[model samples]
Target chain A: MLSLSSQFPILVAIAPLMTAPICALFRGKAAPWAITTIASAFAFYISLQLLLTVASSGPISYELGGWAPPWGIEYVVDLLSGFMLVLISGVSTGVLLFARESITKEVPTSQLGLFFAAYLLALTGMLGICITGDAFNVFVFLEIMSLSSYALIAMGERTDRRALTAAFQYLIIGTVGATFYLIGVGLIYMMTGTLNIADIAARFPEIEGTRPILAAVGFIVIGLAIKLALFPFHVWLPNGYTYAPSIITAFFAGTATKVSVYLLIRYIFTVFGVDYSFEGLELTDILLPLAVLGFLSMSAVAIYQSNLKRLLAYSSVAQIGYIILGLALANETGLTASIVHIFNHAIVKTGLFLSVGCMFFVVGSTYLKDLEGIGRRMPITTFGFVLGGLGLIGVPLTPGFISKWYLVVAALEKGSVIGYGIVALLMISSLLAVIYIWRVVEVAYFREMPEGTVKEEAPISLLVPTWLFILGSFYFGIETSFNVGIAKAAAAFLMGGA
Target chain B: MSFGFFNYWVFIILLMIGLYTVMSRSNLVKKMIGLSLFQISVFLFYISMGKVSGGTAPIVVDGPLDTAAPIYSNPLPHVLILTAIVVGIATTALGLSLVVRIRESFGTIDEEEILEMKDGA
Candidate 1:
């Protein structure tokens, strides 16, 4: 039975990889959708098995191609990785369904199979990146994900020239980030003589005071910061999200950056060790304030955007701030808050973006002015968006609220007035979120309708998946047992393996 | 710090050239060249690290005559760098393809000019 967990990782990864090629066989719209749905479901089931196995036993280690760790490639599935696998694959299954109808409207029929192929390839990369324990293997999987993302975004060129440029811009930044990461990894290898991440951690402490290791940490963090779009490095996200086709925007918003954040956490906590990460340097002092500024400033910018998709893009950056702030706290509670929010944010953002896809279906424009009185016409979608918006604001009875509560508790545990002040500042940021959501709601509900423009709600196909996430936000909000339990365990591991 | 330090200096010079092209140059192709150089800098870093004071390639030979105590350079970093180099090539190719499309669609590979046109639109 324990051996079942080892195969879980490969099954989850290879299922989608195999599906990607077979998806090319089907031509018609229905057939491709059917294949994607089935593949995603299978992948999600494999993730579920992996998660349960990890929960019952402990971290599952599988050496690929019958190779041993430290000398050969390994896939390590602990609580954190298994937890992330579930979130990614679960949301992927839902999104692939939602994308079926949404994509048909956006992309041409001839490109449908190709889009599904790219989708599965992206899923495979994210899953592999989460499970793989080898440091170099992370880079390999990152490229696979990035390459597929570029293709997915570039496929949106038929909709707007802006997507072409956006994809190009992301291509540039992403390439630089990946290159910087490779350099950092190379530097670490130079010092440690190992590519297995756990082996690196075991060896890192002996050379902790060395300059090369320090430099490697610096290079790696900055590179990952760019990939995760932390504050100063987030120039590529808004346009990338806004200009891509609606379905692609929804998928990437929900999955891509979150996967990158998982890698960042894995490196900082698992590979570097928390003491070296937090106390060995002034990294917390440097990172904490930047995170605070990102939360406030990006949320402020998010409020003023007229384009709905772009507004959500900025909000996504602001949300990233919260996660980093949790990391900066460098305590068990703080780590718990960060891990919990990773799941909550994935749910909230997927709901928001899918609702926007709904709007795109009806009105064909995400401009705030164009959506006047749209809520009355498309009540279901608009209501889902509003619930998602409330979740984003950390309103009570939302998953976000549960995470925010934990964050404030974590902050207060620091025993500083400044810590409480950070909570107040977070509260203030949520107020700003309310303002932006209100602006959209006011325009959609209270304002006069455009003459002779009768736009209805999105189809049932889109509505079901969108509501799944929207309801998931509330469901997880009330039922905190799973999130809280897993998060506490994951956090303990992050604080150097309890 | 003698002749070994001299090669390090050349590597740094190439590294800075690559960094400058990525930062200061506006043309996309030039940026790709810069990226390639930047990548090669890391390759240089790995190769230099693998070098032992007096070592040959780490190849094991089996025979009675293989009695000489052979010191060998570290081979793991060299192998990792080979994989990284291939990744770098893929990135360069993909980046250049995007550049081609950008030129075709936007009519400019110059970053500033592209931004200028976008602003005008």
Candidate 2:
């Protein structure tokens, strides 16, 4: 019998791939849903097994089709990637379970099977990108995810024409970004004669200052920045998030950009060793200031949006700033802070958006006005939203607090008083978050109930997933050893140690 | 730097023309063509980098282990470029598809007009 550890990665991708065509072939609602759920369930189970294996052993590297690395493709599973795999697959399963009812309600009935197929394809692409060890493979999986996302976003046809426009704009930007990245990889290959990431890292130091390599760095960083929606490139994100079908919003908001951030970390730390003079070239001078600007400006902008979904979209950009700021510090503590925040912020954002999705399901709109007097009617969901909002604000018991504390500490460790400035800025931003959350709160609880308001909590289907994510934020907050310990190790690895 | 340099300089000019059209022009079809041209410039750059004057095909007709003779430019870059060209074609196709969708939805193919209509709405 094959041990679970060896087969886990292939199983994670193949389950979804095989079921995708099966889902398309089926005719009935129940059968397709069952097949999709089973596939996701199997993938989630394999991911958990893989996580346990990685936690026990160190990184697991497997050669595909029995070919060794530097020539054949490889799959490298380290603690950082295992962390991400569990998150993506686990959240994907939750979203698929939730999508059964959500898709039927929002998408047209005729396209239900097609929607499932696209969802599986997107999940497979994300997993493929996460597990692969080759650069060109990364490009292929990036296209897979992008193409499926465009289809999924365009499916939101009746509610708004803006979805089509958003999808189109994303397509253009995404193609350009991917092409830029391919050019970077090609340049690197021409220099190194190998496309394996480990080989590239081993060779990056010898040809450090060549014009071609610097240009490669520039191209790759810009391409990834666009995908990650770093502040200046984030305009496509707000409309895309706000207008896409509800389940798609929750999934992409939670996982898509997070995966790109993973790639960014991997490329920066693993493919290109961290301690080169290139650090000064990329991080301290340029990315630091942009990250700071992203944090402040996006938060200020998020405060004034009337639409709740748009408001949250801008907040996502601001949160990305926090992650990037941690990375820009270019130290072990700073890198750990960034990685820790990736997981913590993912939990927070997932809870926040899932709560919003619940609100959307009940009220049929996510305008702040629509939430007025909803507190009494939907007390549990309102309370959950309140908890997630406080987490976003970095309250002491919440996961966001841990990430923010580390980021501030990292900045201080770098001998910079600007650490204090960033801490204060973060607090003030939280206060702004409070203002918006309070706007929803006051409208929900303090204001008079609108006439003809119906008394319905969000369906248990939605509430269960939303609460699970909120509880995870708080749980991970209290049990800080796992996140902090692994983050430090991964950060060390990024800083060019074991 | 000689006539060879002039060929490279022309390639750079073509690249800039393509990028300028992509970023500055308002027509959707023109932008697609620009994207294609920009990609073609990169192809030219790779091909130029791999050129070995008076070089024949590097494939060994005798056997796999003719290790002593170096007769040609590297075939690896050419192989890499082939994959890149295929990816480029896919990108162009997808861009055109999106442009078609945009035109159908907005009833216009001009970027400025589309923006104006969006803002007006």
Output the number of the DockQ-best candidate. Answer: 1
In model 1, residue pairs whose N, Cα or C atoms come closer than 3 Å (at least 3 residues apart or on different chains), thus clashing, are: none
DockQ of 1: 0.54
TM-score of B-chain for each predicted structure, in order: 0.87, 0.85
Q: For model 1 chain A, where is the 10-residue window of minimal lDDT?
A: A1-10
With candidate 2 superimposed using the best TM-score fit, by how many Å does residue A192's alpha carbon deviate from the native? 1.1
DockQ metric for all predictions: 0.54, 0.37
Q: In order, what is each prediction's RMSD in angstroms?
A: 2.0, 2.7
Runs of candidate 1 exceeding 4 Å displacement: A1-6, A496-498, B5-8, B118-121
Task: List, residue by residue over A328-363, the lDDT tens digit for candidate 1.
Answer: 888889989999999999889988999998898888
**Leading candidate by TM-score:** 1
**lDDT tens digits, residue span A1-498, model 2:** 667667777778778977888788776566777788888888888877887888887888888887899888888888888888888888877777677666666787777787888888888888888888889888878878887888788776556666777776687677677777877887798688788988888898888779889888888988899898997988778888888888888888888888888998888777776766335355566777778889888888888888788888898898898898888888888889889988888888878888888888888778888788888878898899889888887889999899988988888887766777777777777787777777777878997767998778988888898899899899989899878888887788768651
lDDT digits (tens) for residues B6-112 of candidate 1: 65667678878888888888888998899789878877877888899799989886768858768999988788889888878877887898888888888888888
After superposing candidate 2 on the true structure, give the runs of residues whose Cα lies further than 4 Å from its correct spot.
A1-4, A277-282, B2-15, B43-54, B63-73, B78-86, B117-121
